[model samples]
Target: MSSHSTGTGKHHPVPKRYALLFACCLLLAIALLADFLWASSSNLSSSSHSSLNLSLDSSNEVVAVSVSTPPQPRSIKKKKEPKAVNRELMYLNATYADIPAPHWDWEEMPEAPVPRLDGFAIQLQNLFYVFAGYGSIDHVHSHVDIFNFTSNTWVGRFDMPKEMANSHLGMATDGRYIYAISGQYGPQCRKPTNRNFVLDTKTKQWSELPSLPVPRYAPATQLWRGRLHVMGGSKEDRHEPGLEHWSLAVKNGKALEAEWRVEVPISRGGPHRACIVANDKLLVIGGQEGDFMAKPGSPIFKCSRRHEVVYTDVYMLDDGNQWKQLPPMPKPNSHIESAWVIVNNSIIIVGGTTEKHPITKKMILVGEVFRFNLDNLEWSVIGRMPFRMKTTLVGFWDGWLYFTSGQRDRGPSDPSPKRVVGSTWRTKLHL
Candidate 1:
């Protein structure tokens, strides 16, 4: 009673809500302490794993670790194309420094003894035997003009046999004898003759040989191993060209035996063949083909420049007696009657003709020059002539290429004034 009166009596019991709150607070403090201890253990474990990775890498081991990073986009690559080339510029710069162009020193040879066109020329020793061709507008010549390079003059002029006045004849020489085969004769040139003539150049004598099986104008004739091989020409007219190959046996290496037979029929046969024999191969170059010539009943006798397809097609006689085609000539040189010669085993082609206009069939003379090398099988334009020329006969002697007389602008039709030249142009071919 005394203690209660002097101080406050003993406290009463707590409320139920307050007692529940105190119990919850005590449980939360215990949970927080446990979480801190768990965090420390996880940190120590992570440091130990990183140390293990470093030790493995130093010991020359491979350790792959996967990371959860967002995937990155991949990059693509592209290809580049080649650039275009200029062909014309390439051609102009085709000249080589090592193989400098041929030192072309041209000189005018003595004027030919006679002016003619569509004739054939052969070189024997130092003499040139120019056979008969069209001498005048109305007639063909039978006169043989001999050009003596030794004497530097036309030493002699002889007449062919009265029956042998022919033009557009196929001629070949065997060093001593000249074999004159079929040709177009008479004033009208309508008469295609099969008369074969032989001339002993040494004896200055002429004799008849076995006639050709069929008469043709400008037959592709050449002497192969002493046998006369005649290929293609027009049978009736220049328009009707055939593909018959005829050969005759040479008796005593001079006279032609009577036997005449067809060797082979090849479609490569054409007119105005600039034929040459090199490396045991007979090469036939530009000529005329197809039925573009004046018709049989037409007013003209010879083929005119109308709808004619010039033969740029080349043919070579193989060892097996077959004709095989070679690479074609360049364009704009489709007309035949080009001057050609084999210089240093290279076929050098000179002036020719081409169509003057697309609509008009008339032809214009060209002075383009090109070289074909069999070694490389390539064609290149080497040089050009000083003046336009067509139907000019070409021959090679020593180091000079001789271009004999030919017509300038004259064609089959006599509409233009005749301009035949007798000049002999000599070009020094650089080997």
Candidate 2:
């Protein structure tokens, strides 16, 4: 019927057409795949692995995959360790449980008496300088007692023109001058110190400056970002406590005088307001809002742990000027004394008071040294203090932790227990 069609072939040209169509389709698919592979290869080179997958139906054995990629396996390159700004603290070297040079020896006094009464310590020229705090809790001290490390002796420094003591006065150093601001003579002081002054350790002179916007005592003053942060102390209000956080400009040779402005509401902010300029942030620790805020006029409340009446908590300031609460002190101490030093980026709390009553309890010591890591917000017990003592003032100097004599009401029920310790001890630990 046709031109003698080939064996088993009906319209052979149709098969030829189909073969040609299949070839072109296959060619088109190959071109598209090439483009896809080119684009994907660069992407894959940057990734951990490289591969391509496709399925095929070869019933007729005419259509089949023809990929030409040579298989290649992947390997990972090692990563580089990044650089750090501050010195690294390796915990394994957790060295230094500084006991007194002689544990059994309690000297009537140390060799060089630390020239300090109630004065706050300021670090200048790598040594601590004591400015006007009460020579005794009962006396007002107007003299500046400077402790020289190079000489390892005490020198009566020039006086702060506007000398302050016993007042909730705060001291802060800008690596050059020590600023002594607002405090009163007594804890019951009803009036705020309008007196604010700066002691230029460089020139050995005291200069008076503009006073605080409002008078407050027990304020936490610290130097942060080249500015001074003076935050939350008690300002007398009728029923509620006055609460606010402020930051100030403390630069020299300025057109105008130094001034402060409200930054945040301390009540709802980070770190309940035991702020220190540690790890480059305003670290606010354990705070409350009651008579503990005792506006010098109001009765000052003493320490009470179970009182749970006050907010016993801690918080840290983040980069965005935000607050993050930390795991609170296992047992909160109303005061920062011999215990609770921020060293090696860990809070070292040792030899604090756990007892509320002086007459009955007889110095219940919180001797455990709790080291807190700011990074993980974890607490660990390092060691115990040589003795469980409170009223202890702690300072860090040249790889040593030195604290002035700490004395508590030793004997219970003695209206005036004559147990005042006048000794200085340095820790053997080099943090």
Candidate 3:
């Protein structure tokens, strides 16, 4: 029995080292198989999709695992939106007619002296009536020089009553009666008169009426709906405050008797402003404000002043007396004496003084023509006049725009102290 026990011990269950080696070899083979399968699945997933992933479970067994890659971001392009267009406003035609030839033709006043500067000219019954302006001696004339197109002569002269002898006033006619409103009494007078008067075309006599509520110099006068509308003149001086609009209350039967009615106050007031009645609307154009003094290079003997404020704004007065501001003028005029006429249903603003030199600060005379279209409310340059004109008295009749008694051809180096034009120029109307 001892010998059997010893032999069994010596052969110790097929050697422990060998049994341990066999177990390790089996584990290594299983690991190798698992690695081979994992690598194959990884390659297959990569070929089928964008990416592949692998993970181990709790039991440590070879398992076929799959994970989906998140979707890749995409690039997109955006579209731009369009802008809105204005639908209410209309535009005028870009083209304008050219100025005619022989722009200025001298009309023989034939009288002892020609009509002076800052005078007003109006036509009624084929006769041109010029009145109430300062003469060569700087004396305000209450005289009226009448030019008849029928006889082609200065036929008659009428003197305003002594009470109504005033210059720098507004004049308007209602076919039968010529109305004269507020103005300066004399050439050198700084005080403005509120006195109003009317002249009978048949009798050629002056009669006094109710005075203006706001006495002003160079106020605008117009006849609309048988009512005289007076507007926008200086109260104290050229830029004096308290300027306003007033209308003469016309009695249905009475011709001369009318009461002064207050209308609207002008926010910006100046002398020689342009007023025109068009399309039943009252349009007040460019105006001037500032003191007048001698120019830089004016002659020692002569005297003139530089314009300070040249207005570029335009306004229209409605029935309710509200001023509707319009688009400003492209080329502004310095002098309030901008001449205006209505032709072919459009308002034409003629020559006026320029503000000053950009460097030299001298005023200039320009003959630019601008047309305001009533239908479209747009402005266009209708070419320039043949000659420079400023502070001119203008009138429209018989299809012609007449420019008379204005300053022209003034330059910086040779500035004239008494720069006034006495010649009358006519241009045909072309829309």
Candidate 4:
């Protein structure tokens, strides 16, 4: 396939949207892959807002909620007759707070012999294997890091399958192996490729899998009723991103090939996103979706040519196709960050940056948090991010959340961005 260029490559110093994707993780797997057990806060300061306790029901159904008020932004207009966000929904409030800070991790990764970013991670039996993010767009990644929590350090270094390329994509783990799916090919291709392969944890072997319907970044995958649902991502023909839905069914360890079919119809989501699956539905939180075109039956990448602005809308799709509109976000964003985490049945959206306004002169960091309630289609604003997008990586464990990295605020790609008090922090979530 011939590669395409997105725009004039005009260096837009300011990002259009802020509140981006966080860890779109499942509760069972989060504890397995990321060793977020250690609560570190050597540089921790008290959060500005006092923790408020709201009793939650044990049935696992989401309680309708919304941030309701944003500290009276003496400037931003207050929402009119703010309706109390509903709770019975599944993706209502996609925001909640419970992450411990560990910005120091960003510092630790490089000081060692390895340098990687936008990598993919999977876990099995307290062991996590992260592979494939490169040091930068100008370079290529050729190594993998295996971290053992039981030992509290890097266990070993291994070579990834030569076919492995690109970070900023999707990976899913079955607790036995990891499937590295759709993402770009370094700086070579403008759109992501559907090339996918499986990583065997024991032998550390990579095996190829069937390709996806579309080639794009940030699409999420999940094991639902014995099938692999690959949904969400950004696609471009010549302009903007794409919003489309497709599914991959794998049964008894076999992926159905030549199966790039868009069966169920839907409104295009951002061509890229940090999606998670629950109860036969795919929940798409923050990320970017552009070119609001209506392509009821057209293929995803085929609809890529048209370009437009990005967005931050939380949508839902049951059966992996039909998309339903839900509550709008308090802010406007066409997210470019990775800030997604899944708890029980809820989706947590963490930090990223958004343009200060339409003029795009200044960039403001998004420290806010949002969660989605799938059942009632509501949104809840949790709180502010303790740090920046590039330097933050959040993982949830034992009802608590943890984060690592620098106080990475959004800024133009500079030779040396003002890296801040690198440290770790953790928070206790009131479920």
Q: Pick the candidate with the highest TM-score.
A: 1
Ranking by TM-score: 1, 3, 2, 4
- The sequence of per-residue lDDT tens digits that candidate 4 reaches over residues 1-431 is 33755679635555434323223345556876545433223112223334344546688765644333224434877567633332221121222212333332221322223444455455455555656664544454656666554444567878866665566557666667676777666542344567887777777777877777657665655555556666556563313445455556664345765575564544654543555666666665555544333344544322222334445576666644467866765554433334556665666666554433222223334555666665665667665554444324445555555444323553422112234332334466553
236 Cα displacement, candidate 3 (Å): 2.1
Runs of candidate 3 exceeding 4 Å displacement: 1-115, 150-152, 251-259, 291-307, 334-338, 411-418
Candidate 2 residue lDDT tens string, 257-309: 35666676554321113456677766666433433233333354222222212
lDDT of 1 by residue, 1-431 (tens): 45554346667789999999999999999999999998778666655553222224666787765443332334644446444332221122111101123335567878887778777777787788887877665667788888766555777788998787467778777788888888777544465788888888888888888877778878777777657888887666556667888888785445546668778776666567666677878777767664334436756465444355565677888683778887876633422333676676689877665433332234556555668898775777676554556667776777667677777644422112247677777776664
Task: Order the candidate numbers by lDDT, best to worst.
Answer: 1, 3, 4, 2
The global C-alpha lDDT for each of the candidates, from Candidate 1 onward, is 0.67, 0.51, 0.65, 0.52
On TM-score, who's better, 1 or 3? 1
Which portions of model 2 show Cα errors greater than 4 Å?
A: 1-118, 163-165, 186-190, 237-241, 252-258, 268-274, 287-312, 337-342, 349-368, 386-391, 405-421
Higher-TM-score candidate among 2 and 4? 2
TM-score of each: 0.68, 0.60, 0.66, 0.59
Model 1, residue 33: displacement in angstroms? 99
> What is the total number of backbone clashes in candidate 1?
0
**Top model by lDDT, which number?**
1
* Deviating ranges (above 4 Å) for candidate 4: 1-117, 123-125, 147-152, 188-191, 236-239, 256-258, 290-308, 333-338, 356-364, 373-378, 390-392, 405-407, 410-425
